[model samples]
Target: MAYDIKDVRTAMDPVDNQYHIVLIIILISLIIAAGISVLFTGGQGPGETLNLSGSLVEQDSTGQKEDPAETWIVRILWVDDQNRTYSFQDYPQDTKPDPKSYTFTGDPPPGAQAAMIRFLSWDGSTERTQGARYIMDPDSVTAVLNRYTLMARLSPLPTTTPVTTNTPAPSGTPIPGMLIPESGVVCRNADGSCTARFGYTSRHDHPVSLPVSDMNRFYPGEPDRGQPVVFMPGIHHDVFSVTYPGDATNLVWFLMDKQVSVGTVPRVNTSIMIEPISGYAPLEVRFSERSTGSVPNNPLAGTWNLGDGTITSITGPFYHRYEYPGRYTVSYTVSNACSQARDSGVVTVYQASYTWDTDPKNPATVRFSCTSTGDPSVWFWDFGDGYTSWEQNPVHTYQRAGTYQVGLTISGQHGKGSVVHTISVPS
Candidate 1:
């Protein structure tokens, strides 16, 4: 057949070819199916699933008993790196159902960083309602899911497109002796459901109360002391339903996953007292503890630093003698786990004793001098007459004295000392 090339090409056109049309339709359908699959997978590449599990608790019994129809609406909230939020709602098993445990599985959307499970309970008959929120740790969720088989052929589905969340509440400031929970979690199913385990807080480290108290004590007491508890890192979760007054349902859930760290220990509390701190060379001083902490069997050690280049570890009362006359700074330090405490005082040793010399011309006129070896800041002298002098040396005239009592008192940084002597004047 001698046919025109234009006619032959037109005869083979796709619109005219049934097989070509069928193939084209199949290609278009495949593209649509792929796009649908991505949406259902929450845009995850593949094989990544988030597993979460917890229990549902009834915080309010009064309202549930009054209106059997009082139902709970549970939802999960997911936040992305951009702070975009999405929610997935979960329907109750039935109109009215008993509280029980639940598990959630899904693939998280790309750029998802944080997720929270919110429990909101309301009396369908009235306007009264209450809610509680638990923040989840993604690493914790993964660890828990690793223990179980992921849901077969299941992917995260977004219920709502990305939207701006409320101005996020400020994160709680970290406190001393307290651990701060992880932040920024993303979820797969918007508000449907999410699961997480507290991996960082697992039983390995020592755990303490959130707001520590002096009255709080370690668990498993007596036998447990010294023997550390073995905590396996995995999903640890618990749900609590606390009955709050009024229609409000207050619920708080937590997993004791972390060990408590030691924070500022109790400060060392005590004082030091020294008696006869200063005296002539060969001065002996008595040192003792004035007080210490009220805690029993305290872990504190006591030591003394004698200003004269001597340090000693002593228990109970301590006595030390200074061989040379000099001024020394004495300090005592009480060492304990919490802190080190110290107290300081000065000690002075005198060089010479009290002495007086009579004038060559007049014996009645006597020159009184403090030959004491130590250095005294202040000196006082009483000639036994009605006279007093604040001088290291003073000359006194005895009017008609057969015998007179002379007294000298010295005061220094270390302590105070006094001496008395009898003087005779020729009549």
Candidate 2:
């Protein structure tokens, strides 16, 4: 043995030492066993067991391979039959599951109800599940409901790597839903599905047909005297006409929503009469409404002088007139102390008049002249000769004409008159 140190070292080689080989085989076996344990062991029944997860994930010093064990348990949400959900400690603790509830590991009691259960894991919302998705039977849900209990475990295990997700906001514009204050709403959704709507209307601060959220209220009866009136914000129509003594002042109009479409021409039926408008100011003319329950001040009522300065007395109730042609606009404004509304209509202006000015003997020339008075808005004249004019006075040469009873009319104003003139022409 004392011959050489080198010879002694060589004698200890693995080929000559059996214990080294044995130790190597044991190390290999231990490694294999650890691998098998990584697999989750399931329990009896259709239900499956899931590994515990952590709210946060730990990185391994060695970035080896994808390990099935990689995951974190953030929370446990268990839904029950009533669609209610319950969650216990994310990890097992001394505190017990509700005596009335069930545990994740145990079989549900008979007649128990439950919603979907989840063992969610995450590292700052980079999440994963403990097990594959599980859809319990409807009948089993009842069991979950009866037990209303869920369990979680806290423990760490060797894991592999995980992935990330895309985070974006929900789609579409979300309008705020709010409760209507005091009055609730003036008009709710035509069918009352959701909440009432609030908005602006060019025609009315509060439109009826368009529906509005009415927090406060006023007298609800037809706000505009039952005229199919709607308060919509935008250009719209609101018209009413009044006459003198005979013709009643009763015209009503409706405001509609066209959504920006070309609108139909609105026709108005108006009359004129000489009402002692300014009872005190005799010089100023006034047209009073003959409505049964007439209001003292109606913007639609007006009076005018029937042209030809000589006619002093406008002694009629009211005279009716058809649609006078022309391009004109009539404006009407309605007001209450609280709010105001206005509307207008287009009126086309038209004028025509026949003159019997020719002194029969003077064929080419006229001798007498005629004059008509009042605002086109005030009056119009119809020379019995099938001619009408909105002029104050007109002169003309009679080429050929016969007897004619001239007619005069006042438009929106309350006044109209007629006179006859005859002229003979040689044939």
Query: Which candidate achieves the best TM-score against the true structure?
Result: 1
For 147-219, candidate 1 gives per-residue lDDT tens digits of: 4221222233543323222212112222243432221111112333222112223321122333322222122
TM-score of each: 0.27, 0.20
lDDT of 2 by residue, 223-309 (tens): 333222233212222221111121222222222221111111112233333433211111333332221211222122223333312
Output the lDDT of residue 157, model 2: 21
Name the lDDT of candidate 1.
Answer: 0.51
Q: Model 2 TM-score?
A: 0.20
lDDT of every predicted structure (CA atoms): 0.51, 0.34
Candidate 2: C-alpha RMSD after superposition: 23.6
